[model samples]
Target: MAATVRAAEAGENFPVALRILPARLRSELHATYRYARYVDDLGDELTGDRVAALEAVAAEVRRLYAREPVTDPVVAGMGPLVRRAGVPADCLLRLVEANLRDQDHPRYQSFAELLDYCRLSANPVGEVVLTIFGAATPDRVELSDRICTALQLLEHWQDIGEDYAEGRVYLPKEDLDRFGVTEEDLGAARAGDALRRLVAFETTRAVAWLGAGAPLVSTLHGWARLAVSGYVAGGWAAAGRVRRADHDVLGGQVKPTRSDIAAAWAEGLLRRAG
Candidate 1:
């Protein structure tokens, strides 16, 4: 139902699990992602009275939670899937709140503060996925948190140029100071040594966090295992891109190639098979 909305939000980059999940589960996941993506776009892309648009979206979210007849297409499509999966209402709301936070606070002062933002932005999606898989144990959720947070950090690094152009900066001011990078460095088209060093440092942190979360892969079976491993591999592959580019993100966002994704996917499957 929300397939069109999902495409509008995320151009066919559905999760790796979608390839293996049953049609029903796949549809549910699509709806879920579509809802999140809709909220993000409302906050990030809507021009002129964005706050009003987001407020309207929030009202739609509230309607979904109330099981009322939803007028918004995104909420109507997602409400049933969310209810069926028993995903916590707060989890989805947190995603909306994250985008809301972005409307007000685009630049973070500290890494801790940025992580707090990720709690709202990234962690809820992981929790929702875990719920869908029936693997929302506290231990698993903890592991999922690590993976989701790492993925979010990697995404921030990848979108440095685009984010800066939008007047958003995900890099913490403290880290920038420590690495001797300035806002001007990030704004430039070319990255200098200081900016490269800062990017390297941030990517290393993401790698460490992803590595810590990788063990969650071994704890699952079948498609879930493959899916989690693919996520981990994605983080690593993205980090590899940054490293390969020598962390010069000012030119453009570094992304994993098809070979990188294929190799990482295979490595994930092999790891599970062993």
Candidate 2:
């Protein structure tokens, strides 16, 4: 499980950038990552009653906060770091709630509804991260929310086909109707013009959110600045990939190469410097 978790984390741009941090910080972040990933797996990949599994995980999180014994290895691993970092219980619980919502709510009706889902599913991770860095101020968290939501939308746009296959659709129903896209379009081997236009519209919104959040890098310092710049850069690089693909995300997962991430990272840092 440890090996699998690390392997999966390696593929993400955020974790890839965290490699440069000090060992202690990396370990703390990894513990949080493991717990989040474990919960996500329970929700998405578990064989038995997923809601029950998630409820059990939530219990473990509460136990961790109570300083009681935790049975789950991932939750046990997070206990020390979460306690030490003063991470809020609500942040973790909100994540579990998001997964619970996933079990029942597969399709989002509007972008506002999708954003509400992201408030639960994505934003708390950023809040936890900020808390870990001792930087979870209201202003910073507000900015972090934008970055996190943008990342969530980008991932959704990229995984449209896969999500549709899983009986889930992250794109808003209203947007689909506006673009003349249907569930059938998501299942196609390639995106048609209508699907491409829908992706383009969503991509534009994501980019705007990312841009709105980019100033967060300038507000941070040292490792925090570098780490956040990497995140924002990854978002930009991903947006670039979608644009370059002409917003046809159904061809495959549009992953940004390491070189692409590096270039964007440098450019972002330079922009901040200027």
Candidate 3:
């Protein structure tokens, strides 16, 4: 819970899942935290036998519900909540599985390939939450896809520099070639017009993807609605920030102020009332 809050408050993962969860969901939140932090950490750390580290994470999660097995931080952190909430062990495992894939492969050739990564890296998260809420359904899952995938794309666009440093270029090579963008362009100290145009196009795609899922706002009611709405709105707001910055994402991506979020929330209320 603390780590998830830190990630959210740092404005990295806006619409922090913890804020709107009911009292009963603290455990599930912790389970989510345990899963997300490790999945993300594996990618960031990228150290010392990636396969072994991934296997270790997978083992820890697979053993989570076993009554007699020792509980590590992965289990210890969320053990209580997963027990009470019965968060699917498979969902957590899928996250680790994705990280394993990330360790073995980092470059993505197309938006479709990138989205396939998100199926594990991001989508399982929404699936896990829906399971916790007892709301898993094909229909709702479709909306969740928009939210999750947009978040993933938003993150990739924001982390261009970091990804390049790791020898991983997520921008499809085909797109780069089509735009006449080169490694030199990305390797430059700052983004030039071509790069800016690329980011603008990509950023526009992410914003529209998020908007396509806005109906999820009304799909959930009260806290749940507010939570889903905030996520959708936050994605839109972040897109606007990037757009407002003239799409110089290398300089800095747009981040939402608390007031920006509050304004979004208030507008959501009005829309709901209407």
Score every model by TM-score. Answer: 0.92, 0.97, 0.88
Candidate of highest TM-score: 2
- Tell me the tens digit of each residue's lDDT in model 3 across 112-190: 8887888888877776666666666778878887888898788788778777887777787777877778866776667
Model 2: lDDT equals 0.87
Runs off by more than 4 Å, candidate 1: 1-17, 269-274
Deviation from native of the Cα of residue 92 in model 3, angstroms: 1.3
RMSD of each: 2.3, 1.1, 2.5
Candidate 2: stretches off by over 4 Å:
none
Candidate 3 worst ten-residue window by lDDT:
4-13
Q: Any runs in candidate 3 off by more than 4 Å, and if so which?
A: 1-9, 18-21, 65-70
Give the C-alpha miss distance for residue 117 in model 2, angstroms: 0.5
The local distance difference test score of each candidate is: 0.79, 0.87, 0.72
Q: What's the lDDT of the predicted structure labeled candidate 1?
A: 0.79
Per-residue lDDT tens digits of candidate 1, residues 1-274?
Answer: 3455644533221243456778876777677777777788778887877778777877887888888878988778877677777778888778878988898898999999998998999888878877777778888889999888998998898788889889999999999889888887788888899989989999999888888887888788776765667677777777888888999987764778656766776776687679
